[model samples]
Target: MKPESALVLEELRSKLRPASVAQVGGFRPGADPLTSWFLKGVCLPGEGLPVWKGQPMFPLIQIRTDELPVIPEQLKGIALLVLFHNREHHPFDQPHGEGWLIREYATLEGLELLPELETPYHPFPVRWVSVNDDAPGWEDAWDIIDLSEVNDDTQASDSFFDDFNRYGGTKVGGYPMEIQHSVGIKDFVFQVGSEEKVNWMWADNGIGYFHRSAEGIWQFSCQFY
Candidate 1:
């Protein structure tokens, strides 16, 4: 939280939920997840590879939700979350396997990791970590408390939340790092940024956000610079 306009920021702050943050990186141990399998396909639902249009989808990140330090209510029964996207685009309105895929698991019971995919981004485990100072984007703020409600403090408050530099990072909790506009998409839980260590990068350095819906289903979107 920045000290620039702490006085008027409380309204925005109260609308946001704070949870334990986690970093999804560290390629050691050779068993970490989030490895890039761009061209290669993933075995989801135990049937066949997930495809979009005519191309196959690849796994972007794999999280053992049960491994997190603090599992939020939204992720209660989820044991694993494997995110997937087409080689080029991510059409949000499309169905499950059209442009992107979010594979959820209730348990790791019969799970298996494929052999060699020859992907550039190596497998880095998603682990719990401390969250840095951050707040939702201005649009997200406006939707929560409304700009009109803030009265004369509009400009200061907008600048505070819209500053992407202050809030951008790859972490599990807190607020999302918006590259463009804030998504009114509720239940802001985790954020993913291009990790350089394992050669992880989305678009020209995009940031992805995750939100748990009221139905326990996760909604996501990625924005790039």
Candidate 2:
């Protein structure tokens, strides 16, 4: 690789942010999810949670923001974020918050643990671990500065992006590793990949993406092979 390209690659690498990854240890009442994704937590009652087969819906994920590593500045005061998927809705094709839901809490006072609820699949317990591995895929270039330097040399370009594929799994911050391609969601947040060990599958081994819209609303979508 040319020295100019190598220097540009180093500069580009400096822009990469680390995302906390899910190591997913065996069951525990509550394990630290690298302080990024807390799957279990107490919260105010989900008073209007949609019903399914006579049972209220189970939240797919519960994230505590008190310890989040990377997040938008506006969410600095938020206490928790929760996600719910309605079995009645399409995994990725429905309107935001209609089929899927993302709720953020401002405080934790008077909260309680989520009660046992029915789920379509076995909800295996998992926890998060911070990982230094995070890099934007070519698809995520729009979220970063111009890629002109990356395109400066084929070899340098190839070397930098080559790391993204090795990180195809659940992560916080950074970019969502593409199952098909990025949906171009703005203000992206975290993602959860289908875990075979936990039987968490999105369609045929897809990944779930959680992000925020321009209006500051959180949304959910899934992509699969």
Candidate 3:
């Protein structure tokens, strides 16, 4: 969408292969020094280029030019800020002074990874969030509960119930709150309130609530007490 972002996306789209995905931390086209930097300076498996473990990444998946529904009509392209950090000390341990380069593009090809990573990770799914054009009325129907009211000791709730349907991006009625379901593209649950004590062990004390739009977008509502 922006002039600088337009240039960056065009450059990447030209160098990418069809149906591939690569990871990068940051991208700057006309920086005086380096053009781009990795997340925590972690590079690809063997390449010497600097990269990071949980850098804000864009998985460029190839598709027919006519099939991408989310590509904005005005912006040249759109880059979603997908953060992949599962490590215990992740979001906090990231390198300092690094921010995601959100951009807009006109087409689907204006994004990519280096040739090496693309060959193996290409043909992957391209999932990004765009505005829901056909959102339902339920968009305004949801609630947020405090975990303090739901005691882990007795696994009891004052008023909140374990209704996974409250959070949806599709048909509704399914929320995976355990690590076991983390293997897929499903929404995982976590305990709300007091981030210091939040852990998988407190499954019974879960209090976060979310809802999904029919257009496959998730909306979350959480209240920590």
lDDT of each: 0.59, 0.63, 0.25
lDDT of candidate 1 over 64-154, digit per residue (tens): 6665655656677877767776667546445555677777778666666633344556555555654445466656656655554344566
The list of candidate 3 runs beyond 4 A from truth reads 1-114, 118-123, 126-159, 166-225
Candidate 1 Cα misplacement greater than 4 A, ranges: 1-7, 13-16, 19-27, 30-48, 53-55, 88-95, 146-166, 216-218
Error of 2 at 221 (Å): 3.3
State the lDDT of candidate 2 residue by residue for 55-174, as single tens digits.
455576666665555554536677776676666545576666566667677877666666665555555454555656566666665456566766877887888767443355666676
Q: Count clashing residue pairs in model 3.
A: 17
Best by TM-score: 2
**What number of clashing residue pairs does each candidate have, in the order they appear?**
0, 1, 17
lDDT of 3 by residue, 1-225 (tens): 344434433332333211111112133222211112212111233433223455333222222222334332211232222222222221221222222111222433323433323211212222222222221111121122223323332323211233111222211122312222221122321112112211211123333333323443433433222
Residue pairs with backbone overlap in model 1: none
- Could you tell me the lDDT of residue 80 within candidate 3? 29
TM-score attained by model 2: 0.78
Candidate 2's clash total is: 1
